[model samples]
Target chain A: MAKSHEETADPSIYVPSQDEDMLKKQKKKEWKETLVGYAIISPWLLGFFLLILGPILASLYLSFTDYDLLSTPNWVGFDNYINILTSDPRFVQSLTVTLIFVFISTPLKLIFALGLAMLFNTGRKATGFFTTIYYIPSIIGGSVAIAVVWRQLFGRNGAINDILNSLGLSGLNWIGNPDTALSVLIILIVWQFGSPMIIFLAGLRQIPGELYEAASVDGANKVQTFIKITLPMLTPVIFFNLIMQTIGGFMIFTQAYLITQGGPMDSTLFYALYLYEMAFEYLRMGYASALAWILLVIIALITIIIFKTSSKWVFYESEGGR
Target chain B: MKKQNSKISDVIYYTFVAAFGFVMIYPILWMIMSSLKPEVEIFGNAASLVPGEFRWDNFSRGWEGFGGIGFDVYFRNSIIVTTLVVLGTVASASIVAYGFARINFKFKALLFGCLMATVMLPVQITLIPQYILFHNFGWVNTFYPLIVPAFLGGQPFFIFLLIQFIRGIPRELDEAATIDGCNKFGIFYKIILPLLKPALVTVVIFSFMWTWDDFLAPLIYLNNAGLHTVTLGLRNFMDADAGTNWGALLAMSSLSLLPQFILFAFFQKYLVEGIATTGIK
Candidate 1:
């Protein structure tokens, strides 16, 4: 049956006249369309090759060598990576600080976002106004100006300490104390919970009303319904937010650069900020390239781990009755 | 009983929201008020929302800026870079998205997968090499490193966003245009571009906001004081040993936030919708 279908489908083999001409013309048109498609997307295609692909490969190559900004790279295989892993105290400190920030701030941010989303999802009046108000921080969160304000707000004699003093409680220097310095940064991260909250709100909107109605009919309380219906359905969105927020947490630069400068004992020394210092400040371009690659690997590993575990919890409406 | 319970719940909900809202908004309010406060009065009256005396000197002083460069120069530079970035992002992303969404081509799926992978790849991975590449091209210290990438569809997020939006548009419209003697470009220009207004607005707002608020890119690229952006200008206000001019800093910070505040206040629907659609679907 396949052979017969192939024989009939090949029009040029039997219909050697107008039919063949038409087929050729049709094929030509498709080719022309494809060319036009490529033409339309040429900018991105060119960018992908030169800007993204070339740089990625170049960075990988540079990671294997020692190149300062002043001189050509001297080939030194695996030394940078080895030093980073075994000897560099600052690298270890930065890695630890970043991991702590990511682990602490991401979950806290997600929880705050989820909570706010749930609160707003309760059919309140003027939700639009509330969401907008909540979202404002996220808009200006990464600016140098905000970082400066954050510094002042947590400074020794700043607004936070002033409030503490008025309340009859002694205030420590929030930004100055090593123990609380990282916490100030984390607070900044958690404060910009708008994006994830909006995503959660969108996810909540997608939950079928019938599920809630059915849960209520079955005598399930609000908490029970949330756990059984809402949480399960929202898992996919939660997973997405988790991955994005985690990646963002790793690449955090501006806040630390502006607010802390990886000081107060390098408590808030983010990986990206350290990388910037290496490349720009220390002029260790090759070492920074290696650091960048390590960051990439770390992010990729985390993303893979999340995706690998997602099948267990992420619910898809299309995969119902499973 | 149910009505009374709901009323009680509503009151609690509003109170909770109001309290949290105050916390969220207080910092900004404080910043604005501090900007207006007298220099000595700023730290002295930190706990008070009301300024002891409104001082307009901070604004003038801040606007004068550090060194010879002023806020006007930084603002102009920001506007120039941001405008070009927004324009380039929209044009390139739309064109690229149209190709992905509407056209059938070889390696399309593979290319799209690569784009998605790149989205997850942290910018740090390519930062050094791109910097070096730009350095080699003598593009560093100029806006080329920042602005040219936008023209080349450097942002995967915006492209993905536009693709999602274009996919939502009906293919039947394209087919109708095709029948009316419109080529693919014509179909795009006449049909898709008009319908892509909302997504385009979202892209414009986002690109503008991100570029305006971006510190890292400008920090790395613009080494010249005259070419500094507003973010960089604000950063120069800090002197580690001498202490910051809090009044001037707050004043400039308030000014820095004004454009974003205005944009968000007016086009909030687009902003929320953008985040919702981009993230969820």
Candidate 2:
């Protein structure tokens, strides 16, 4: 732009060589733009290389070796992976716990989220206040404070039992029982339905009113309307919520780490919790790196699988229909 | 008859809403009320919202933190880390977003794709390597590891959030600024940043809350009780195997949530907006 202004301001007879000079100037300007672009994004460029990419590759390499924090990493060449796949009982245990947690909690959480979201999305007045109140848990749900309170509420002499006794019913040590321990965590996850609920609300709002109106015009009942128009339209949001929650569920650490300490017989040992213990608590950095890589693959595979299958279920409007 | 039916439905809806809302916030209210309860009644009167007698001693006791350090130290560490993180996230995210949204460079599409991909890259993937890097940097036991990456690029979500915003700031404004001799950087602060207020505030709120809530980093890096953030400090305050003062522990736990509660009270609009827009986090 400055070059154009300069050219207009010159208002002089152009020499033949001026064509080459103008082209050169244009090329220089393009080069300058590139330089400025890189300069502006230099921080991210530095961070991506140093923090994310470097660490990911280094972690992958470390997964192949056995290195405690003290000693140099000893390359064991697939031994760690072999043990994780073939032999490690805790690895199997953690994976089983994580898979169960993800599969159970995700659908239940989404169902609550979708059900509540549909209820909130009604054009009825004054629902915003209730929505806000309902959303409070998801905001602070992951905090250590809430996890602390959650532990107390289910403890032997805690509030849950306190209420149970007053109701003339017996109460078990909910946190200490292996059978109920994972269920307690699942309850905690489901309780914070605020996030996916809000996302569902947004998705619900995006749906065209005419779709429902058209269904009503066809004399469709409430259930028919919901199944015919609403469900398909809401599939995309459900898919997004599903992937996000599944990933989050797999990475659940603090609650298990703090509330259950990954036990009553390792019943609530989430994968991330186990990885943390391996690396930091047990100082098995290399083995933990292997665990981390396995987690990375698991998440990647899950995300990819969901995406691959999404075409069959996810109703994208731009694609015009399933 | 129709009016009566509608009226009955309205009553039912409100009743359901009130009951569910109460149940949703019950745990939080219980914690807050229990924080003020005397030790005997804290457990004894577990289901009661009203303590037998209000006790302020719990706060003072909790404030006298573990290892002779106080809650003030934890709060100070959290405040320092959160403030720096929020600032760094906003600044770096906005600048990087402007570059992607407004400029063209070699590998621009590829780089933009990289940014999008990193959003799904779990922090655990980098956990060990990052720890090793910081350890080699002599940054262990310091705030450097916790604080530095934030200054570098922060979250990819922040960058993505701001990129959407910058793209919406009509290109005419940038051209106008250019004609007035504003360079790219000049156009950024002068023409773009002020317009980016709401989006930047969103980044600020999210980063502040996330960094404040972050436990694993501080738990791993800052083992020294003196250097622990509130989240880390409170986690240690009540050791699972050891008997903890439940009164003091609940008191501090409730107190630790104050900043986020305050932020929520003030800026829930931005928080909700950010979440609804992204839907990933």
Candidate 3:
């Protein structure tokens, strides 16, 4: 039985010389491929070293120094961090604003985008047209012009209030009021939900039609089918949307920078915007680097937590298990 | 009975979706109308859905209002910057992506992962040091800082997207080319380049949209109003210190969106499909 098992396993294992020669030739081929590959991929490697990796390493060193733009950086161990964490209300405010924006916008976006995706998925007529129309806002929506338009629309005499007045109502100064400034931002973000919606639509297509058909034949109602089949199938896409939107939201800057100027009482001071103000406006390069590092840590922690939690809820089709 | 129930549910769904759509689109519609409304009528009848007069002259005024630097200059500058950036980025990113996807380098996966991590790193972290570096290099206040890095494969997202697409192509094609005595360069040129047309289109479109809309880079790098991109030019026009011309600003804003709108209308299908293919994955 042992001999038979050994023979079945391929006697190549026992013939060491033959195996070694084959392995040597395989390694030689692999070496050639690797060399050729390096030749082709050299551009990216060069880029990483020169542009990305080099800058990253430089920033790490700069964060340790009291560096302004004009002068040479002097070593100032942890002073920047200490000052930012302890003495800086601006940093705290920026953090609070960014967190609020991320929390509100991420959930709202996922719901709006997923809902719109469902709408397009169901609607029989010109689904492509609706998809395109919905997506237009996201494509052009990041411009300073759009942010300016958003500001005008929400300003004291802006279009939003105009509509409210037409309805025989008083209007709140949306962008000018501290309480409403960030809310207007939230609205702006939710409006640009078209990109995620397209992704969800693609995910929706991947769901087997027979599952829905089966659900219908089993006397399942529309809500029941959606709940039992569609939602579960779409969970992966929803997970993707959640992570991406969360990350995107955390990096929010342009809307606040252009619209509110982080104003109406600093209520809209997003972290990155504040970083810009510190580095450029105030010329506190060291402090700005510290802020950047803090933002990085926060983003990293959130992403790690998301990945850890994903194992519990994220469904994988190949595994045949949720 | 089930059919009837589903019909009602569908109606409910449509109502919910339509309400969301109305809200989603309302601000844009409102902006368009507001752009047409005169200053006198703006606040007086703020809620009027229709403008009293379609004040088409707002465009002309907005275009010419910026201290003799017509909106045409900013528009033209933006076109130049975006076109060059797109061409440069697409070319570099494809070459780099091809290298990563099709080549068999040592530690290839590790290197690729390192490249992707750059994407995760907030652009802000690199912002200060890069600005300083550029300043020392005398690239500041010029289009060099804006456009040169793109040619150096600066953007990780486009490279990653291209890599994913390149990997999906069959390796057998490369082997066949090699058997037919095509060199590595020939395989890349003849076999891979043709296959990557769809991905290249996607890269071009994305680069166009991003470069056109970028404000902060131009705000930081370019100091001269003469060299201002559309985003910067419009903001400069509306700056409170520079004297705000609301009507003129609105007109300029509308013009800024026109190119992207036109691009979208023409390539909406490819853009959407490309986004779905590359981004969603």
Tell me, by lDDT, which candidate is best: 2
Candidate 3: give the clashing pairs: A162-B46, A162-B47
**What lDDT is reached at residue B280 by model 2?**
40
After superposing all C-alphas onto the true structure, candidate 1 shows an RMSD in angstroms of 2.6
Q: What are the Cα lDDT values of the candidates?
A: 0.88, 0.89, 0.81
Local accuracy of candidate 3 as per-residue lDDT tens digits, A1-322: 5335435655555655675667667778889888888777666677678677777777878888888887888999999899988998988898899888888888888888887788788746556756766787888778887887787777788677877887889999887789998999888888888898889889998999999889888999989988888887888888878888888876777778888899978999999899999889988888788888888889889989988898788888888966
Candidate order, lDDT descending: 2, 1, 3
Candidate 1 per-residue lDDT, tens place, A1-322, comes to 5336445776455655676677668768878878988998999999999999999999999999999978999999999999998999999999999999989999999999999999989887898788888988888888877888898888888899999999999988887788999999999989999989999999999888998999999999989998999889989889999998888888889999888888888888889989999999999999999999998888889889999998888888888722
Instruction: Name the best candidate (by DockQ).
Output: 2
- How would you encode candidate 1's per-residue C-alpha lDDT over B61-133 as one tens digit per residue? 8898877778999999999999999999999999999998999877889999988878767889888899998
lDDT of 2 by residue, B1-281 (tens): 99999899999988998899999999999999998988888677777888889899989989988677888999999999998988888889899999999998889999999999998788889999999999999999999998899988899988998899988889999999999999999999999999999988888877888899998899899978889899988888888313458888899999988988998899878778777887744
Which runs of model 2 end up more than 4 angstroms from their true locations? A1-17, B240-244
Q: Which stretch of 10 consecutive residues in model 2 chain A shows the poorest summed lDDT?
A: A8-17
Docking class of 1: medium
Query: Candidates' DockQ values?
Result: 0.68, 0.76, 0.53
**Whose TM-score is greatest here?**
2
